[model samples]
Target: MLAAVFHENGGPEVIRVEEMDAPRPGPAEVRIRVEASSMNHLDLWMRRGLPIEIPMPHIGGSDIVGTVEKCGAGTVRSLLGKRVVVDPSLDYDWYRLARLRGYDGEPFRVIGEHTQGGFAEFAVVPAANVVELPDGFPAETAAAAALAGVTAWRGLMTRGGLRKGDRVLITGASGGVSAMAVQFANEAGAEVFAVTSGSENVRHVRGLGADHVFDRTTTDWGREIHRITNKRGVDLCLDSVGEAIWPQLLRALAVRGRLVSFGATTGPAAKVDIRLLFWRQLSILGSTMGTPAEFRDAMDMVFRGKITPPIHAVLPLHEARRAHEMLEAGEVFGKLVLDPREARP
Candidate 1:
């Protein structure tokens, strides 16, 4: 099996394609013949040196769509040969407890963070993490859609508690997760507002049902958001830009509104006035990836075309380095996919 492995954390050049032994499933696990996988910002974080170092020669990817080649002994026998998408969150068992109390047992044990991930032709995952893909579903779309979609779904529906007639603001609208957030908020009958840097993506975000699009490059977006809502601000603000937008987003939130965040793509540190929180009665919620059930529920909408994946580019697995570079350079409008079959000899 050919896999992309990085021995040192640095730049995209560190990632190399090489022949590696195919992984075998353990009991309660399944070996997937990986057909398609997608890149995420998490992959970039793993590629660079984070506080926690992955094992040297690590493979990085989370979103995967494949067919079960074999099930481990004592695993459900019926899963073999089934097409499936993997929930990359490894904490399937503790998700309930975590959601109830905000307890993520250990930060480093996430898939592609601690263990090997789906960057190769063959990958092994727990059977419980597999969500059966509908027949005739496009594997590329499924792979490109799962992780980001699930993150947005959980953040909006479960954490943010978004409801009909609510106004929601999503920062960084061109990214995969924010694009999904825009669509999910709109489909829930909420008015969607998007802040994007590029004018080209304004129409794209609008096509996803965003009621208002702010050009962050040209406008003081938070003030525009306030004006659009008649100074009431939004009921929810989904912010991932971190410090760069934190103060502005806090100012843009309606009284008692919630702010849900999943990642800090820019930088994490933020300085906030205590008065804002106390006076506005604001709720700040941090979300990671979704639970297995949430992942399945989100993918259902994706498969049914109620929301569609926005693919920026698709490359062969050997081109994984270039894909990572594109993501790091912020050149992609949406998710970038890798086709393992194209890279095989």
Candidate 2:
């Protein structure tokens, strides 16, 4: 099997397209013949460097859509040949307990981040992570939406407690998660305000159903958002570009507003003002990749075409290195996919 493997993490140049042994299913796991795998910012981070320990000879692709070719011992034999999307979030039981009960911290695991992922023709994941798609569903579509869909759904809806008529502000709106966030908020009957880096992305984010879009390069979006909202501020602010605008995000929020932070592309060290937080009665949430149930809800809307994760491009699996480069360069508007079948020698 051909895979985009990196013996060590450094940069896109570290990725190599080479033949490797196909992975086999382990107990309660299944081997997926990967049809499509999409890129995430997480892939870029894993390729460059992360604090966590990752498997050597790593293959990075958390959003995977494929067919179950084989099932391991004690697995459901009926799953074989089913088209499915892999839930990249791992260790859900511990994750759920840790969140719900505040138990001692459990090791956080994600498919592409902690273990070998789907930048290969074959990948093995726990059967529990595979969500079967309806017949005739396009695998590439599911792959594109997988991780972004889950993350956006959880952060915007689950954690933020988004409601109809709510005013929502989404920062860094050009990325995959924010792209989906715009659509989800729109569909849920909320007014969506998006902030991106340029005019082109501002336009793109608008097409994703953002009611108002701001280009950070030329506009002070925080003041603009407050201005547009008549100084009442938004009910929720879903932001990932932390530190750079964290304080403004808090100020831009309505009293008792919920602000969910899913990522920190701008760096995480924010000089927070305790007064702004308490004075506004704000709720600051830190969300990661969601639970399996959330992943299922995310994919259901995606597969039904009620929500579409925009596809920037589809490249051969061997071009995973180029995908990483494109994403890191901020050239991609939404998800970029890898077609394993097109990984020609």
- Find the candidate with the highest lDDT and give its number: 2
Encode model 1's per-residue lDDT on 1-345: one tens digit a residue: 999889898999999999999988898999999888999999999999888767678988788889999899788989989999988888665756767768757542566667788888988888988889989899889988888998999999999999999999999999989988999999999999999887888878898889999889988888888888899999998988898889898999999999999988889898787799999999999998777788888999998899987999889999999999999888888799988888753
- lDDT (tens digit, per residue) of candidate 2 on 1-345: 999989987978999999999988999999999999999988888877888888988888887788899999989999999999999988867876877878776666889778789899999999988888888888788999988999999998889999999999999888989999999999999999898988899888989999999999999888898889999999999888898999888888999999999998889898788898899898999888788889989888987889998899999997888888999999999889999989875
Name model 1 segments beyond 4 Å from true.
95-108
All candidates' TM-scores? 0.96, 0.97
Candidate 2 Cα outliers beyond 4 Å, as residue runs:
99-106
lDDT of each: 0.88, 0.90
In model 1, residue pairs whose N, Cα or C atoms come closer than 3 Å (at least 3 residues apart or on different chains), thus clashing, are none
